[model samples]
Target: MTDSNAALNAFFKDFAQNLGRLQKGADVIAGIRDSDVDVGSTPKRLIQRRDKVELFRYEPEVEQRIDTPVLIVYGLIGRYTMADLQPDRSLVRSLLAKGLDLWLIDWGQPGRNERWLTIDDYVDDYIDEAVERICRETGHEKITLLGICEGGVFTTCYTALHKERVRNLVLTITPVDFHADVDDPAAHHGFLNVWTRSLAPEDIDRMVDALGVIPGEFMSSIFSLMTPMRSLTKYNVDLVDIIDDKDKMMNFLRMEKWLADRPDHPGAAGRQWLRELYQENRLFEGKFELSGRVVDLGEIDVPVLNIFALDDHIIPPTCSKALAAKVGSSDYTEIPLPGGHVGLFVSSKSQGALTKSIADWLQARDG
Candidate 1:
């Protein structure tokens, strides 16, 4: 090679190395932010979803036994505790402060018994049972279900199947139409059609039989790839800030704890989601079957409120906004917030505005 060419190659090599260093540094910092070590621990209560499912509960309420209770259901992939971070910046606390009785659905660590847990089992069996229990406890026929992201679809499915149990419905950052033009295929590795659809119930069993519980790390890694460099960049940034402020370091550590604390999703439901929602676009098409029935959005007739983030990477507008069209609830309203998927619930910016808006939306249904 010529001398000029060699010099230019060396410069490019150094630039590549530097970029790698920067990304690695940030990932480390971001990991720190997502941990239990950095951020102060949250106050959580344990609720028995069944005799076994130990759902975590966080109540920041100074008052109790209100007229209409609030139930917050998080996505199956991530721990529910993400919504209950710091007291000063908590969705649970904010709802409680608004004088609403609150209950959070923490789907807890699933075991082998939960291995074959289908989306049917979750929406029909677990959620329906929980709603029934909550209703009996409060003596109210209906309860407000606030579902976030993937949970929103689950909630909508439940409402459609059993509208009698749901009074007011709230869906935030949920993806109903995975086949939307804007939905990011980056979240899943292969084409939604071939790989996921090829898998049968036996396939899911074998995959889980080989590994006791599917490692949350595998799922987290996929999410990290969506913003390949962001996690690394945040880690480096956290370390630098840790040099000066102790709270920032603590906060960073706490976030890392939460981020790392991903619970495994049951393989069967995962396979179904991959095949039905992502691959075939069943839910939006009114062909998504759960618990022996097709999911027709027209069946979701209760008062519904949909919340979307202006820039949610995990779920883009197409994934979230599609709900506006399918649901039969003419009493529907959509609120778009200025934040990313994760930031929509946790950021300080959401505290003053979006959180209050959430409570206000719930309050109108309190009567």
Candidate 2:
């Protein structure tokens, strides 16, 4: 063949291969959309609801269930569905399989009217009611509290204020000491920590006031900005790489669905979080108060299991490691999982490790 003819053949071959891959990827995506790919498929009953807050109890799967039910407190920023992303990769399912009764608090998306809702409302009102209702139904005074990320901060506060209400505490990727970056520069690796710390208290107030209720998409965008290169590659390079693998593609899409489904945050609560915890670093100082009551971590003498993602960009290990020293609990344990923030719950390898560690720790203490 002539030089031009040879070049044309090579180009056509490459185009044909690329086209075939694109067609396969599109077919897989279409199938995923039409198929019964259920997320958060675990059965649960809504036992109680107060305003936007809802308390749900997952149906028991074991012959003999644990007396203490674990109440999961996911951050208000994202829905709790992340813990139950899919049947196989679900933290909920894993815990259920281990014979632990599970309960979850879903703080539904905040609206414009909810702009007035403060951190006190979440900690003092929603969390308080949920815990009491769980206690009332189970005929137990204290229940195991599992908090994730920002929810961990709230749980820590609640545990401190009402030590009698919590049997055991589990915090996953929780940022206990917001000023951790100040003490250790390694914690300053994440953009979120550095960005929030740079903002002034007045700046936080002004931003919150300007936005009646912070949009969930806005928050999602900020998280995406944390790893700009990774975010960009997910749509381009990563998607192409996993296009042929239907299982992997489905898992990726499921995670994308969860990430897109962010919840608007209450303006008042946002202001307090940014000002008191992020900006002023009042949490570590024991100066952060909810409804006039100080949230002193030293008061949490209950058994504590604090988990932090070693490779988490959003919440550095230093931010969560401080929990071991701050809490008054003699049975405090910190597990640094090998994954990113959200990956700790969904990643196949980490999911087993995460659930196993949590179950074993809780079993040893509660039994």
Top lDDT model? 2
TM-score of 1: 0.81
> Which number leads on TM-score?
2
Question: Where does candidate 2 have its weakest 10-residue lDDT segment?
Answer: 181-190
Q: lDDT for model 1, please.
A: 0.74
Q: Lowest-lDDT window of 10 residues in candidate 1?
A: 188-197
Give TM per candidate: 0.81, 0.94
Model 2 spans > 4 angstroms off: 1-12, 34-37, 183-188
C-alpha lDDT of candidate 2 relative to the true structure: 0.87
Runs in model 1 deviating more than 4 A are 1-51, 55-60, 64-66, 183-214
Q: Write the per-residue lDDT of candidate 1 for residues 163-188, one digit (tens) a residue.
A: 99998898888888776743355443
Distance (Å) between predicted and true CA of 38, model 2? 3.4
Candidate 2 structure quality by residue, lDDT tens digits, 1-367 = 9999999999999999989999998887777653455677899999988788889999988854566889999888888999999989999999999999899998988888899999899998999999999899989889999998999998989999988899999999888788675666654256787887787767677767888777898889989888888898998899998897798888888888788889889999888888788877788888999999888899999999989888888888888888777889899898888989889999999989999999999888874
Candidate 2 lands at a TM-score of 0.94
Clashes of 1: 33
